[model samples]
Target: MTRTPQSARTTTRGIPRILAAGLIVVIAAIAAALGYQSQNASSSSAPSPPSPIAPRSERPGSLGAGGAVPDGVTVFDDGYPAVANLDPDLLRALRAAATDAADDGVKFYVNSGWRSPERQNQLLREAVSKYGSEEEAARWVATADTSPHVSGDAIDIGRSNATAWLSEHGAEYGLCQIYRNEPWHYELRTNAIDHDCPHMYADPTQDPRMRQ
Candidate 1:
């Protein structure tokens, strides 16, 4: 065999080094791609945060049923709706009476109870608007100052069953209907628990208290 040239031998040795450098670059590129893939996979699998919700008690302008009354606000108890701002004696008596009535399958509900002067006046104004005159409105709504509702001394029950029950059993609890036409209206008659309820007024017109 002829002796190889020195330059050719040198060039032949350089070829292995070039191939080794290329192999190293290829391995580094593969490792970098695998690292990126692993990071992306880990980030995509993490959990998202939960969304929030509000309860009914958080609503504005009105307190929820079954909740404690807020500060400076006179609202009803869990069992009584539309009954607020009442005399403590009256409310206590009414609740006691309602508890008894419930035992006999009569659940007493209040359709109307105490009202602020503004509320009473607004009602009277609306009534006058509906009836076309104060005289006609007096047949239904009373002046704010004279209205028992503004005084927290009156309550209005709904449902004929409850009213009928009150007609029969209310005297025992001192809740007596005070008007013939307004059979739903009742006032605490302390004497009723001992004797009998006072005779009902024929109407608001005839009630002597209305004149005052």
Candidate 2:
């Protein structure tokens, strides 16, 4: 048998060590890349923090015993005391008017109707604050004792279109706009159905009914 050369044997053995070292380097590089990718994915999937600004909550006692009239209440919504507690004659006239108004693509939304005395007083106070004095406030909000809303004899309609419709045709149903400045304000005046509405007061301050 021929003797093998030491240098050739040594070189053959070093080939496996070189390949093993390169394989180890490749495995280490792959592991590092996988780790980096996993970190990026974890951060991307994280949830966001809560919002800083919150919605305003309703104040205590903002709504009085009668409760406030909701935004979309119509004359026919008896579920609300604002509509149901109105004077019988006035409610009847409003319902009749609302029925007819619907045919013209109009809706009689009750912006304000019956209010408790407490609610009226609160409104008066708010008005006084807004207008800077009781005298000026009186032009807009009446005293709780004298306010027709407390007695369910008054209603404040809403949306310009509804008021326009009422201005043209309210007299037919005995629903007359009482104040020139407040075309939205209305009351039942049965005579209006025949003789047309009486002269409108400049504002609530000029109406004798507000004095009481």
Candidate 3:
């Protein structure tokens, strides 16, 4: 048998060592990849935390802010800020009138009542956009400072029958329409029970209160 050279033996031994080292490196890399994938899977499967509850003092607006009334909301619905936030005397008169209106087969639905200053500003902006000028917008939407709704002293009644009932008997409850142009708009005038309501303004623009 021929003897192998010393160099040949060294080369054959080195090849197996190199291949073993490469295999170990490949195994370590695969294991590391699998560990990372497992970690991500575990993280993805975990349940998320629950949402926080809104504070009790935080009230929702009909327009997603405070002091808006939804359709069909009545004076009796004190749950709404629109009804509950009204001036005490005004709310009292409204409830009294609403009770009598119900007896007459009419419901006292509140179209609009108390309004946040933000909501008033929003309405004013919308009015300006619709009528093409702030001068014209004043006829409909009042400034936040001048709007009785912002002060919870006025309410807009809904439905023709409810307004008709108010037209006929509202003075008994001291509820009076304030604007001739807006029959739905009512304000509490306690003196109206003794005397008829003060002369109606043609619109909000004509009201001296709007000037302030």
Candidate 4:
């Protein structure tokens, strides 16, 4: 029996179809490989977040070597009258500095410390009553937000001779006076000594409550 030419042509067409199928498979495999490689490259290129830092005081204890509070420092809780809120470390530093100052015959006392929001409001109201305006009162007594005393990180220290002494030596104890106009008010300033001294606050003006 003779095979028809048409049958031969159909067999040749089937060869091409098989070849096309193989080509499609090759293309799909290449595409899948490229997609996987792209995904891996993107993942490898992404940046990692930074690790968190531990507090300075938590390091191994070694007399100013680790983060522990300095020697000869005492922690005082003045019943919120001297400080509305005080970090334990800062309180220790203040007591240390004050004791050192006393040794030098420069005695100091904390006149004002922390104030609650309600207490601040009361102060503001009193200032308004005395000054006849909230704005004028703010110049003397800070508004709620601008008042560093509210955080318990600030204190108003007084002593006829110790003010200058404190100004000169407070940095050694991690304390610094804020607002040049308010010589009595000092706040913690060093993270190594006191972690409470963050540079930024919600309001930095003398009285943020008076802004609006």
Candidate 5:
């Protein structure tokens, strides 16, 4: 027996449904693969953040609690024509020592205090011009680095007898006469860092704070 045209038409319509279902499954698989690849690429491309650095500690023997000047004392730059400046504590000690010496009939005066590096250089040049060489001038006045006056930690007292008394009793006021060769110069006996430069006669015109 022969097949009817209606039956053939029904077969064609069922084939189209099966093809559509298969196409939907293929599109879903492709979409899932693309989503997985995108997630993996994003994870691999991202960067991590860096860590922070630590701060450094302060240097030892620097001016502060254990500085050269003793506690409860402050330094002032007495506008002396010869000296550079004076530490507050050192000035207090000097005033105290001078007063004490005066009570014992020993008159005292502050001859010198701070010195600028430029003034020191001028003195050095003068010495070189008059004496002969830099070495010979250095013998009379200390080089910039060796100048205790530049540090505002030294003072030159006028009277020898008063200074002698200070040497004996100055420690009570936290003062000490540094450099045995120069009896006139006195410094604070505290724990401040010591500079190796010696004292020199500097010009009064330069800035006191700019000294070596």
Candidate 6:
């Protein structure tokens, strides 16, 4: 198309305003993205303990761990891998206990289990960012070196009944709660089957095992 001198001049003059409007839009989009992220972080603040367990009639299928991963179960959704990345013995014991719990109308579900060192560190950093300090974060997330999650030996059970049932009967299964503050965190303590579970640490800071 032929450009008239008058038309070319007008086009050139409008370029600055178009560039300015585009810059404004880009800045606004960035602001909106950041705001959405901040709101999501605030809303997803670490999950607090859930409510007490509600009793239900005994159900089958979830009964034995020897079978395939059950329906309605997925790694991120239910936190149970086809095989938990936990310590072999510990994972075996957990499955056995979960099978038993299923017979009693409780379904044992994993909330957190077997974290990679990188994942553990990321969680710690996030916790610190959320809690405002490392000390405060330590109360919840543990260091990668000391975290049983990183070692693939700890399991955090979900569902109140699973935890509650374990609270009362876990000794039989050799699953013991580790932290008083984290009732969901359980570890395989074969000795606990005969002896009572050890005195619980009030939090990570009190646990000598967590020494940095």
Choose the strongest candidate by lDDT.
3
**Error in Å for residue 123 of model 1:** 0.5
Clashes of each: 0, 0, 1, 6, 14, 0
Better of 4 and 6 by lDDT: 6
Candidate 6: minimum summed lDDT over ten consecutive residues — where? 58-67
Highest TM-score scorer: 3
Sorted on lDDT, best first, the list reads 3, 2, 6, 1, 4, 5
Cα lDDT tens digits for candidate 3, 1-212: 99899999999999999999999999999999999999999999989988787776564433324677767788888778888889999999988888877888999998999999999999999999999999999888899999999999999999999999999899998999999989999999999999988899989999998998
Instruction: Tell me the spans in candidate 6 whose CA falls farther than 4 Å from its real position.
Output: 1-83
Query: What tens digits encode model 4's per-residue C-alpha lDDT throughout 145-183?
Result: 766666667776765476687677877888876656666
Question: How far in Å is the alpha carbon of 48 misplaced in model 5?
Answer: 87
What does candidate 4 score on TM? 0.52
TM-scores for every predicted model: 0.67, 0.69, 0.70, 0.52, 0.47, 0.62
Cα lDDT of model 6 by residue, 1-212, tens digit? 97579978999999999999999999999999999999999889968789876544223323213222344442233234324556888877877787787799988766677776777788899999999999999999999899988787787777788899999999897889989999999988899989989999999899888896
Say which prediction, candidate 2 or candidate 5, comes out ahead on lDDT: 2
Better of 1 and 3 by TM-score: 3
Superposition error at 129 for model 6 (Å): 1.2
Model 3 TM-score, 2 decimals: 0.70
Local distance difference test, per candidate? 0.76, 0.88, 0.89, 0.64, 0.61, 0.77
Consecutive 10-residue window with the lowest summed lDDT within model 2: 55-64
- Give the total clashing residue pairs for model 3: 1
Question: Which pairs in model 1 have colliding backbones?
Answer: none
Scored by lDDT, model 6 comes in at 0.77
Itemize residue pairs with steric clashes in candidate 6: none
Better of 1 and 6 by TM-score: 1
Candidate 2 lDDT, 110-132, residue by residue in tens: 89999999899999999999999
lDDT of 5 by residue, 1-212 (tens): 97669988899989989999999999999999999999999999888667554433333222222112222222232334233246677777677766777788876655556667776666678878897976665555666666667667777776677678876677777776655556777778654224332333233223243344
